[model samples]
Target: MSAIASEVLISRLADWGVDTVFGIPGDGINGIMEGLRRNADRVKFVLVHHEEAAAFMATAYAKATGRIGVCLATSGPGGIHLANGLYDAKLDHAPVLAITGMQETSVLGTGYQQEVHLDRLYEDVSVYDQMVVNPAQLPALVDIAIRTAYARRGVAHLTVPNDIQVAEAGEQPYQLVAPAKPPATAPVYLPPPVRPRDSDVRVAADVLNAGGRTAILAGIGARGAGRLVEQLAVALDAPIIKTLSGKMVVGDDSPYTTGGIGLLGTGPSEELVEEIDTLVMLGTNFPYTKHLPEPGKVKVVQVEIEPTRAGLRLPTEVPLIGDVGATLEALLPLVTPRAERPLLERYQAKMRDWREKMAALENPERDPIAPQYLASLLDRLATDDAILTCDSGTIATWAARHWHIRGGREFYLSGNLATMAPALPYAIAVQHAYPDRQVIAYPGDGGFAMLMAEFHTAARYHLPIKVVINNNNSLGQILWEQMVLGYPEHGVRFGNPHPDYAAWARGCGGFGVHVTKAGDLETALREAFARPGPALVDVAVDPNEPPMPGKVKYEQAKHFAEAFLRGQPHKASIATTLFKDKIAQLKES
Candidate 1:
């Protein structure tokens, strides 16, 4: 018997080195599910509680592994559910292929059950969108989807009709053409390294040499070029400022780095951006344009593999379009080394002061379990090579300011989209990628509740993921945002009492720990880390504790005061905590 289209689809994916498929199954995709089942030894299907989580898992897997992440969903609602995560991949430029089911070709527009125009629905989010109407189209379509995703560094979607999925495929050899090589029977596809031209590299070097104080803003693009980035920093006597996605480029405690940039950044970094004459951006188009040095004030030399992203965020005097490692290798030789290191020294000192200020906030003896203290405790307990993920909101703030990046540790969060609840799913995918490494997910109460069912998914897989929930019982980030905008906090708090997330973990066949007091936080985190399987540590933190920006503007202070005057909830406690934190920061200054 000829192989079915679904079998061809899975076979082609495995040929592209895809080892896992993340998705939830439904009747519409039953044929595809059988394909996954038959090819279980080749490509494993991870069952997710929700289609959205599956999409998130795929996006994160792509980001973490530098491979084409594939996600599957049934027709109609399942396909619609994938939009958010696919958009996340698009914005962050993760290479992902979404395989969603469609109604039978006979009833595509007849409004049949689960009849979703998935190809039309995915056009905006995908770099390549197509539907397989025949079995012969499956293998070629799969190859095109994966190739397009890799080439464009964005989502590629292939929607297959139910009838087409089970149809017999024609005899076709699976041929994979390696870059600059003839077609081979073996499945091997490797992307060619991108390099900037010598002339462009020289122009960038000239721009850098012209400036006196140069600061390197390392983004996610500098992931594999840490040593090169350090060499350039040392040569220029420059301080490195990491974007959130670029946190692992260098350790947070490195002397060359002033820590992160933007609102979740360090005060020294803010000052460094204000003072630098030249800014060297590596592989990161940081979305917060306001935090960047004003155009023309700093001569910008940007290095990026994607040409469109080179000058997107800041005005570039010289844009070197190429791989970060390759570009840095070419430009570093032409750039002149500096001897005077006053600016780097000054920023290093400020970074030390910032660390001291943060230490005071991370005091474990504080009565209410401070989220900073919880993050610090987890940092102390996690392994050197642990992979940590955090959701957006106050949890991200705590993770950003408190958790120190050390050793081989890596951190990931929703970068451009800044969506909530991806932490748990990301942790699951990373754990699947590296089973032996410690994987932790830190999410706020609101975000955790959004995708809480995924905890059971972790349990089902025996993923051994440690989830630490910052149970503030409120949408803490938005509450502060409202206050910052001079509006009273409204509808951000959870009117219903918060559920026992720890208990839920236990119910889902995992270990659980609840820490209501500050002193118990360390013990709880330690226990969760040591547990044999998936675990949850739910710590009730102070909801009134604000995530203050690195440098508070007078307008922000005025608006916060105005919010209190306009009768904000928990105004007294919020004001007290903010005042106390500010006083500590001022003392460090």
Candidate 2:
């Protein structure tokens, strides 16, 4: 008997080195499910509670491993559920393939139950979107889809009809021309890393050498170029400011590093950006143009692998189009090292002062639990090589400011997408990818509640993931935004009766710990980390603790005052908590 098309598809995926798939099974996809079962030894299918979680898992897997991550779902609602996660992958430029099932080809246009126009639905999010109409088309379609996804570094989608999947491989008719040979089998090909032109590199180097004080803004594109960046910074005597997505690329211990820049940036980094004459950007397209120094004030040189991304955020004096590591290797030899070291020293001193100020704020004496203290404690306790995932919100801000990257640690987040609820799925994927390494997820209350069912997914897989919940019981980031914008916090508040996430984790067959006091946080974290399976540690933190901007503009201060005068409930408390320690420093200044 000949193999079914679905079986052939699964075998091809295994050939492409896809050992694991994340998805839920449905009747519409029974043929594909059988294929998975038949190939169970080669490829494993993880059963997630929701299709959305499966998509998120795939995105996380792709982000963690620089390979194509696959996710499957049945037609209609199951396919619809995948949109959010797929969007996450699309925006973040993670390579992923979404295989969604469809009704029989005959029923596709006849208004049948569970029928969705998945091809049209996924078109916006996918780089390659196609539906297999015949059994013979399966192999070629699957091959193209996977290759396109990998080459484009984005989402590829295939909607396989149930009828076509179960059909025999050789049963379908093929169109052949008389006296013509069969088409040659296409070989698997991977895209090579791009290299910048020598002239472009020389121009960028010249821009850097011409400036007295240069600053290097590194992003995720610079992941493998850490040593090169460090060398370049040393040669130029420059301060290195990392974008949030590229925080782990350079270790915090590096003498030239001034930490993250922009909204969740350090004072030293923000000041350095303002004073630098030359700004060299690597691999990051940081969206906040306002946070960057005015274009005319600073000469900009950007290096990126993707041609379109170069100079998209800010005006570039020299756009070096190439892989970050390769471009830096070429540029380093051309640039003249700066002789003066005063600017670098000034920034380093400011960085030290900023760290000391943050240390003071991380005190355990705060009445309501200080998130900074918890983040710092986690940073201290987490393994040196641990992988950390953070959700979008105040927890992200806390992690950005407090989680010290000491070289080996890996951090993942929804960079361009900035989506919420990715922490759990990302942790799950990371744990699955590197079972021996410690994996941690930090999600705020709102983000955690979005995909709370994934706790069961973790237990089912027996994934040993540590999920630390920043339980502020409010959409802390949004609330802060509202206050800064002069709007009263109306819908931002989460009314009492917040679900106990730790208890929910236990209910899902995982260990759980709830810590209400700051003193007990470390103990609870230690206990949770010791669990053999997944564990959740819910720590109650102050909801009013704002993630203050690096530079508070006059408009922001005016709006904040307006909100306070309008009788915002927590305004006074939040204000005192934010500025009390800074008053003495302000007086001295």
Clash totals, every prediction? 0, 0
Best by lDDT: 1
Q: Which segments of candidate 1 are over 4 A away from where they belong?
A: 171-190, 582-589
Question: What TM-score would you give candidate 1 relative to the actual structure?
Answer: 0.96
lDDT of 2 by residue, 344-364 (tens): 788888888878777776767
lDDT for 438 in candidate 2 is 93
- Global lDDT of each candidate: 0.88, 0.87
Location of the lowest summed lDDT over 10 successive residues in candidate 1:
178-187
lDDT of model 2, residue 420: 87
* Model 1 agreement with the true structure over 1-589: per-residue lDDT tens digits: 5567799788889988999999999988888998888789999999999888988999999989999898999999999999999998999999999998888888878878877798999889999999877665656677777887888899999888888888776423344474233232333446767888888888888888888888999999889899999999988989999999999999986889988888888888888899889999998989898999998788899998888888998889888888899888888899899878888788888888889899878766665777888888888888999999999999888898888888999999889999999999999999999899999999998989889999999999998999999988999999999999999999999966669998999999999978899877777787788888999999999888988889988999999989999989698887677776667667656
Clashing pairs in 2: none
